[model samples]
Target chain A: MQTNISVDLGGTNVRCALVDENGTILSIVKGSSNPEKGAQAIVDKIESLIKQLDNYEQANAIGIVVPGLIDQEKGIITAANNLPKLIDYPLKKQLEQDLGKPVILANDVKAAAYGEAISGAGKEHAIVYYISISTGIGGAAVIDQKLLSGFHGFAGEVGNVIVDPHYEAIGIMNAGAAEALGSGTAIIRIGKEKLGQQIEHAGNVFDLAKQNQKEAQEIVEQMTDHLSTLLSTIALVIDPSIIILGGGVMKGKDVFLEALDQKFHAKIFDAMRDIRIEEAQLEEPGIVGAAMLAQQSVSH
Target chain B: MQTNISVDLGGTNVRCALVDENGTILSIVKGSSNPEKGAQAIVDKIESLIKQLDNYEQANAIGIVVPGLIDQEKGIITAANNLPKLIDYPLKKQLEQDLGKPVILANDVKAAAYGEAISGAGKEHAIVYYISISTGIGGAAVIDQKLLSGFHGFAGEVGNVIVDPHYEAIGIMNAGAAEALGSGTAIIRIGKEKLGQQIEHAGNVFDLAKQNQKEAQEIVEQMTDHLSTLLSTIALVIDPSIIILGGGVMKGKDVFLEALDQKFHAKIFDAMRDIRIEEAQLEEPGIVGAAMLAQQSVSH
Candidate 1:
């Protein structure tokens, strides 16, 4: 239940906060990140954010989560697609040295999963599988309140899992990857293609579907089916007690969450149908989860 | 390096062995099982086989592995398609009460995975993923030499994973599950349908492919592709250091294993291309792995 400092670094901004055991954000600061300026600049901005925080000296440790893969053993960001310039950067060492405190680095999505497993919808569960359905889908698992990061930090990399072998992805991922089929980016792209109009985002497509737009509804249904398949595939691998769905796309949960859960249950084996599918309940899970990561590292 | 007793109960036979810490089979026995007679009969068969082993009283513990889903917490067989009447049967308590020894029960495939991780093909690795491609396709994982049996014991149920959502399965599995497409049964079924001839088994299909029969080769290629997809899917979830391919289907490894490995690498991320795909090395991994599982429970 100790207070910890957390920094959630993403493409748009670097969000810093003082999160306690209850996942409460006591104080927060946000700074725009020009990742194009390289890792040092990002580090400077983080220090500035820390300087702006109240009671920063009282925090136990600092945890930073980047939106990409990390070589956890070395505490380096191995890949950050949105922050392309920072790949292979040693973020943990720099932060711990600069801030003069223990530092823990993790993937943003994985941090959120830990937050959910400990303080949100999955708090009561021993095994929680979390999927973030945003601009791109990502997933991670928290087992017995510990993040199960694999040797190469590729554990719970569900985004690249193929749901359909026949469909080809435009990028390095497999054709019909869940990220390519069910993510907000995919929904937006499919919406514009099918509706023959500029669909603003995944929410707009859902709105169109709510208004009885056939094409938009079909697109949403397809995404739901693909996501269900992705969920079942995850169940096939590790049948966690609960699966939490989070991310920006969850804003439209009312439109498809129930149906998506149903489809998922229908697809899995009868015994596994008991696995719960729930929405993530934490407001700022990423920052809070990063704080938990700090707590874990400090205690360990 | 204690010697433990292991019972690997499959449909055709109940194999028992005294396995040492190094996965060496010091003594062994196999008994034909009349699974149709029910759960009690199977337990009696196991006891009779154990009686046949030399120096049985010297073993540290006993481990039983069934080729189906087990309710680990309750030590009961939840489901076993091959041994249908044994579902919901408490095999562990029964064996413990009868033999006056601590009994550990596990899925046969998972036991094999643990066997590989500790002393078989994947002995040198910390994380090992094992897939059995026989009449059906099944998978299991051993992480840090510990079997990661999920809450529902469905941690490695890869057979039901859908590879092609568009294809329909003849049974309860998803339309295009890996088992439905890549398994030995699938090869025989596809071969018979496409070749307009009686296909004895998976090996015959491979033999035809080796003889330059275009249709048979196509079937083999398609099965290999499905299995590759299955392997990539496993890597996407838990990027294990080594993946061990086992089961009856591996008998045709000379024909398709190299190509299947290549296809699997081709489908995964560049960073993960280092994951080794190899064949199972142990002569009887299931019995050996069960002994390992028994050792784990006893030590813990």
Candidate 2:
């Protein structure tokens, strides 16, 4: 099996792993991303992590997943909330030159969907909608075994679809958007404002809800309602064979899934009730997805 | 080029056309779909139309475009809004038995989208989203030259996606949905409720708006906003290479298209500014789309 290195770059850290054809991680390494040190430092950190994987086997190809609106065709990182200095940087070319291998870059959430579609929970479904409910809501879709990157490579931005048109919020906060109502960031923002530090983490909020905390329960219920609304919209639009849910918020929240499913059923048209909603199988879908993408690129 | 017979069954009319492989309509025929005379009468009307086409040329395949939910695999017209008796009827099998040729059935809007994608406005685009803005909003999507019929053949039901979650009206009345805001039905509904019967018809509404009627202008602007919201959602989610706008409302209303485009651009994120929205080229996309489906079935 050909060996490749896959990296998941985020605000705080950069995680790299050597993966085989079967998506098995042979060796893993991590390094901190010091934004205070600047874009060159981040590049340096990524290079060091690539070096750690270099000892295991010569990397045939490298795949990097980053959080941002990426220009994949040009291999440029357009804008990222965390890595501000990396804007407009030709990341693939820089990484390829430094690592001495071809490098491919993609949005982290899209990479995770690719990972799930190729080897994780969505493997059995032909069409899959993969959503991550983490610090913020992010999504990507896989149809007929291929990632559906739209004309501008921003196809699965489901979180931005406004769900509450009456709300004063604009852009991603519009009424129908999943992020506006259900995402972890939205949850934290709403909780902090409404509950006033009653819940430290979103998980704790969910825990509080489970333990019968009235405010926390209402908040979680509202979040689930928002998720269901988004799911119903997805069902009406894509009507995928299966929907794979992941991210930090969904890791241990089975009841939330149930509530979402119930709400989805209640809201969706009669023609779209059979769609299966399931949890993601891969522990770290983003890393796995990056590896899978590298494997696909190499194979093709 | 093989000859195919395409039939578009509507509430009041049963339109038939003999089409060639190049999407040319060789001959056309029409008759009333008198449902009061029962399903057999409708079948007889279809057979008579086929006979009219039979006099001109021999048909190798037959395709029927029906309005409502269709069970494609089973050839069943599950439930139709206009033709009540079409429910649970084996449409394809019955048509094949009557015409003595292979028959294919698809939702009318999906057929129109397929037609537009193959030979109409979306010919060169990789992804095409066709929206039919007539009495009610209907939509279908073609991705990578393949029709996206979700797990249960209901993939492109974009009209059902909720546009206004706060609205009490169920089905398509939600504010954010294209049908709720821009559809002819919505216009009539709004006119009846807000402006009363004096302004009847979408043309008069547009005319009044053109003449600087505040109420009329507000009604149109609100509808455009709703359509923009839905289009923005579609842009963010599907990110089609080109969006083809068709249906009765768009055929003569250039101003609606202009307003829709402006509102769509304002709502969509900067990452998806490059997607081109255009008007559909097919004169009768439903009939042409039915013919296209027939040809695809034969080739496959």
The candidate maximizing TM-score is 1
Off by over 4 Å in 1: A34-38, A52-54, A81-85, B32-45, B51-54, B81-87
Worst 10 residues of 1 chain B by lDDT: B142-151
lDDT at residue B199 of model 1 (Cα atoms)? 85
Cα TM-score of candidate 2: 0.89
lDDT of each residue in A18-125, candidate 2, tens digit only: 987667778899988876787788889888887877554576788888888888789988888998888887888887787677788879899989989878888888
Worst 10 residues of 2 chain B by lDDT: B169-178
Question: Against the true structure, candidate 1 has what lDDT?
Answer: 0.87
Residue-by-residue lDDT tens digits, candidate 2, B1-300 = 678889999899998999887788988999999877778889989988878875434777888999887888898888888899878878888988766788998888999999999889998998888888888787878987678888888776777777776656545333345566678877877877877888567777777777888888898888888888878888778889888888877743655778878878877776577777798898888888898888788878
For model 1, residues B146-214, the per-residue Cα lDDT tens digits are 787887888888999988888877698998899999899898889889986778888888998899999
Best by lDDT: 1
Query: What global local distance difference test value does model 2 have?
Result: 0.80
